[model samples]
Target: MSDITIRHNPDRERFEVLDAGNVIGKAAYKEYDGGASPQRIFYHTVINEEYGGQGLAGKLATVALDETVAAGIAIVPVCPFIKKFLTKHPEYSANTAATTPAHPEFLNEPSPRARA
Candidate 1:
């Protein structure tokens, strides 16, 4: 295993995990910035199946959450992986927020994921 790197790709609104400079996984989010409280709603995460059991997802989640917190933005864990990660990491509770109805409604509509 080579050095695993995680970087925020704001253009994609996702944090990508790279293995030796090749993107192997990403934790995707949708950022809502107009409101008084901005948030990054994480809804998808995926790692190359070949990279399974390597803890890449955990690392990806940790970096994603940490960076989101550092940015002073709330994290709305809409993805099962992220939601579960939050449960075991209560330290992040201060920066976490419940998904509101608007979140669901927005998710239901067309999105970058759908377009992709």
Candidate 2:
């Protein structure tokens, strides 16, 4: 555990958790026109290898999901870690206006593809 700070940079459109001064985890989002309105999509997020398996990624996702809910944005869990996290924690599922596609079929691998 370290002195961590969680912050969302709207300018860069990313949610991050910092340890001391370095970013330990982050979730990135992008906006696009979804027919009649703008949609914020959670694209990707990563926890630094040094901080892996310590639950920092979950913390980052929770904070990001909270912020997205406050802003009234629909969620898209593009990152496998985030998808798995959501599966385990259904509380955050309320933040989403619509559910994302089913969790990627190959999520059991140690490193899952996120760039889809």
Candidate 3:
């Protein structure tokens, strides 16, 4: 993990984790207005099989949430990993939002995936 780097790719609407310049995994999400604050609803996360068993996913989650807060955005942890991570890190509680039925519905609407 010496060469690991986490980069945010907004056009693709995800944060990517690269090891030595190759993408090893990603945490994907969709963002929209969440009333109190704009929200990044993380719905899926995966670390390439070969890269599993390490703590890369946690590292990715850390940076992703850090950046989300830096950008003045709130995190909606629909993804299990993200949800679990938040539970362990209560410091982020203030920046997190609980999921609502409409959050999932928004993900299904046509416009969210139009950029892909």
Candidate 4:
């Protein structure tokens, strides 16, 4: 089994999962200045095809959400994968916004994964 290391790269606005020094997955988000606190809108998650089926996505999501909660930053799970992941892991729900807009404009924007 390969050891996976997760790290938050704020400059790139993403949490990367590395397998032996190679990036294998990422969870992307956009940050906003929320007055008294910061907010993060998670918009995308991707794992290399070769790294699929290894539960790396879940691991990435766990770390990303965990860190955001630790920092007291509100989370807006706009990405379907993140929404679903949060649904399955209800413990992290407290870190999310009380009410996310039904349709966020950012959802319509093209994601890097989509552009690829």
Candidate 5:
């Protein structure tokens, strides 16, 4: 497999993961400044089905969360995938908004859309 590179495209409000120059996955987010601090809500993540089960999703999550931390922006993980990833990686918790729950149980709860 070719090396995968993750790049943040603020104009698109998402992070693109490219494999050998071709986009294979993307993590979409929305920026908000209505809170105490600027934050990004990671609302969706998707990878080409062909790229599934290869850990590409985890890699994309890592890059996206790392960039959010570096920019001092809190993260609201509305996407179950991202929430689950963060649950396993507590180091990224510091970058989450104060209102975000700290327990994995809360993070793992299914969203309304998922429940339906």
Candidate 6:
């Protein structure tokens, strides 16, 4: 919806998509310093149950990722949804900072959507 507003709170490390004054969806992540610059670790993605299956989560993720990427920040998707999204959109893999993390199992297995 054109009226939906996605806002990011850097201090809280969360982003929310509001629809007509109601927060219908939200995605949250923690920023890791990694001894260099901070990299966002996508930890959670949730769309209000009422808003589920409407693609709101995807929209939230897109905006959040775009905003961070525009600011030159890399991302690590620890959330299953986000990992699946990145896997389906290999083009976005370029935005990922680490192909391998201290615990690689944390990453959600990539999807074949983009490859299809």
> Which of 1 and 6 is ahead in TM-score?
1
Task: Itemize residue pairs with steric clashes in candidate 6.
Answer: none
Which candidate leads in TM-score?
3
Per-model TM-score, in order, reads 0.89, 0.74, 0.91, 0.81, 0.81, 0.77
Sequence-dependent TM-score of model 2: 0.74
- Compose the digit string of candidate 6's lDDT tens values, residues 10-97: 7667899898977777788766655365577888899888767778888888989998788777888878899888877787787887
**Regions of model 1 farther than 4 Å from truth:** 111-116
Q: Relative to the true structure, how large is the alpha-carbon lDDT of every model?
A: 0.90, 0.71, 0.90, 0.84, 0.83, 0.76
The deviation in Å at residue 57 for candidate 3 is 0.1
Among these predictions, the greatest lDDT belongs to: 3
lDDT of 5 by residue, 4-104 (tens): 78899887789998999988889998776657888888878999998889888998999899989999999988888998998999998778874454333
In candidate 5, which residue ranges exceed 4 Å CA deviation? 98-116
> C-alpha displacement of 86 in model 6, angstroms?
0.2
Model 2 residue 103 CA deviation in Å: 15
Q: What is the lDDT of candidate 5?
A: 0.83
4 against 6, candidate with superior TM-score? 4
Model 2 lDDT vs. the true structure? 0.71
Per-residue accuracy of model 3 over 1-116 as CA lDDT, tens digit each: 56888999898889999989998899998887957779999999989998888899998999899999999999999999999999999999999988999999888888735667
User: By TM-score, how accurate is candidate 1?
Assistant: 0.89
Q: Output the lDDT of residue 49, model 3.
A: 94
Stretches of candidate 6 off by over 4 Å are 1-3, 99-116
Error of 6 at 9 (Å): 2.0
